[model samples]
Target: MGTLFGTDGIRGRVNQYPMTPEMALRIGKTAAVFFRDKTSHKHPKIVIGRDTRLSGGMIESALVSGLCSQGADTYLADVLPTPGVAHLTTHLAADAGIVVSASHNPFYDNGIKFFNSRGFKLSDALENDMELWILDDHKKPPVIEDKAIGKIFPVSDAGMIYSNFLLNALPPDIKTRIGGMKIVLDCSNGATSTIAPNLFSRLGVEVIPLSTSPDGININDACGSQYPETLAKKVLASGSDIGFAFDGDGDRLIAVDETGNILTGDQLIAIFARFYHQHHLMENQTVVTTVMSNMGLGKALSDMQVTHLKTTVGDRYVMEQMVASGAHLGGEDSGHIIFLDAHTTGDGILAALQFLRVLVSENTVASQLANVMTVFPQILMNVTVNAKPAISDIKGLPEAITIIEKQLGDTGRVLIRYSGTQPMCRIMVEASTKTEATHFCGQLTEIIKIQIGT
Candidate 1:
């Protein structure tokens, strides 16, 4: 009876609650019905893809069975990125696309997200309709004739199509100029395991790939974006120009500088914004980011006389705001960068390519490209509690926060918000220097914990 989908999708630990195989089948049928057109007669078609999660096989089969039961044709593009599913949906003109992935979450978790025919994430309105159908038990099984049962076929070129598209999206000179550039990529052993190495090799970069495995459990296992310490060390040890780490689903990306410094999504945006401007590719010279972006990014954009817009924290919200504002580039601080000129959804592989394009075009190094923006030191700490209280009910919390704000003044910023995907309150502080930011963050977190700790 509760809402079936979370901020991203229907996610839970494998075999638990919403993630059970039975529920997955139900969701698949509901999705097929929602996308079915009675007049098509050729059968509604949908494409399904998944990350390297241990539960992906079970979930994928359940989805296939349910979709077929509705007489909906299905295409299987196994072990592909989330964006690849989105791309294939629109490219092949399928009625819908389904992806089984939990993105940056650990291997124990899994999820199901739908993409509309246009290759964009489904709107809240459409999801609401599906929820209504599920509650009313309006779903109908297929009334298929003996020959009308839908068929499932494999897409042998799914990775090649996505990789080729990413390469073409770059400026022509990038491939030649970045041919000798040395870079390390940690694919998280998920979706990028197939596409990334081929894409970079085709681009002529000296690529060193880590975590390249088909095994599901290996994804994000002390590598990848969420666990960057391993990648940081690898970058230094390999002495590569830099490194890029992707999430399990390959929609998000984080970077390591030549000095082994981790670069967050905000810093990457600032760098790309500057590069795009230098090449006259930044339309209206504006960039879109979430409120979670660092104050340093705003300062960098302002210094360049470029515009910056802030949306809510999620990539979906960023995409919506970008569309409304006619902005071409937008993303979250968690490495979910979107280049409207490249792909409908954020693609980690594409993002890395774009970064390479800029470096090659300007004949610059990764460290030099990174210098386009000066990142303020940021400190964030999350406090887990029994319940998430309203921001209004906590007395003196606001006053204490105000003190930190005044302390930082114009040189920094503070963000205190709740984690939508988890039960925790996060306190973030950004200042001109790391020491000052850490001190303020420590002080604020201690105060809030005392006031709200269980």
Candidate 2:
């Protein structure tokens, strides 16, 4: 067997090798053993949560069985967001938390990710140990005796607890300020379908919810953050002040302004960074973003006298840098924004609330607020590859990238890297114009294809 974990977690098509019930069970057992051995608690507890996926029930049952068999009690937060699970883990003081959802992927795919006691994703070292144990026949989990066996129970108030936490994160006067503001929400028929709609309604917003009904197979079916065009149309048609689209697991968010223009995560971050700086809320006068962020965002941050720190792709790396630098804001261009003072992981609903707070407090509209930073034209291309070779080993790829970088000079930038969660290489270019960005991006894609494409 190969490594069971990826950048996010163990993910694959449902019923496939890594996503199968057997593998989920083994993962649960191995994770229980690992956590139990690491903690001083004699009987550790694990919390499991999942999105509205057809395979979620099957995977959740297997995980519960394996965890119980290993004498680890389990609490089930059924159909909750990824960030909700992370929050519940720390709230309930569980030893660990597991989320069963492949994020923004199609419904046919599933995944499992672990969060430590502190409500953060498990470190690579811990995941590696669990992976080794999963494949170790000699270390197979031994079923506990009858008296020591663990029990599983439902967390009836999980949603309420998480919702209250999110509400409290906002200013006390938020409801009064946002009252009667027409807002559209696209929940992607996944975890936030209920939570987001109810939360917004309670906050006195005129909420027009889309894709709030999840029938297992409809999650992320051309309606989530991955496809904001539908939401954009809805926002314009409904005459809403703003719109927010969340991924299947509610860890990412993409916004649609009133004019039906979709705002990239970079634009959102830039807006918030300036707001935070003006309000003296930004710690260390810095914000963190992934390498995939637009160069325009960096330029904007510099103009605002705020430092910009770039981390490797992935919210985990962004969070790591934030914690090290004491930055209160960090996120990816893919819409995974992390508000360290608010929540541990990327909570789409929480981020949306923060954005709304900024708008209400500033007494401004989405389009005007979004104009705080000028977004340069960016084009990204992904090329399938047969192998994962080091960038240095890719003949002519470096020279090609260097030439493009020098040609673009200070007005543009180029980034060529392999996707951490997929079998593809991503070539991203940002230039002064759409034509320049697209033309150069196409050239780089061809170079990558010839050097390493499948």
Q: In lDDT terms, which candidate is top?
A: 2
Q: Write the per-residue lDDT of candidate 1 for residues 347-413, one digit (tens) a residue.
A: 7888888887776677666777777777788999988766667766776778878888898899988
Write one digit per residue (lDDT tens) for candidate 2, span 193-293.
Answer: 99999999998899999999999999999998999999999999999999999999999999999999999888889988989999989869989998899
Regions more than 4 Å wrong, model 1: 37-41, 137-148, 394-396, 443-454
Clashing pairs in 2: none
Listed per candidate, the RMSD to the true structure in angstroms reads 2.5, 1.7
**lDDT of model 2 at residue 191?**
99
lDDT of each candidate versus the true structure: 0.83, 0.91
After TM-score superposition, what is the CA distance of residue 73 in candidate 2 from its true location, in Å? 0.6
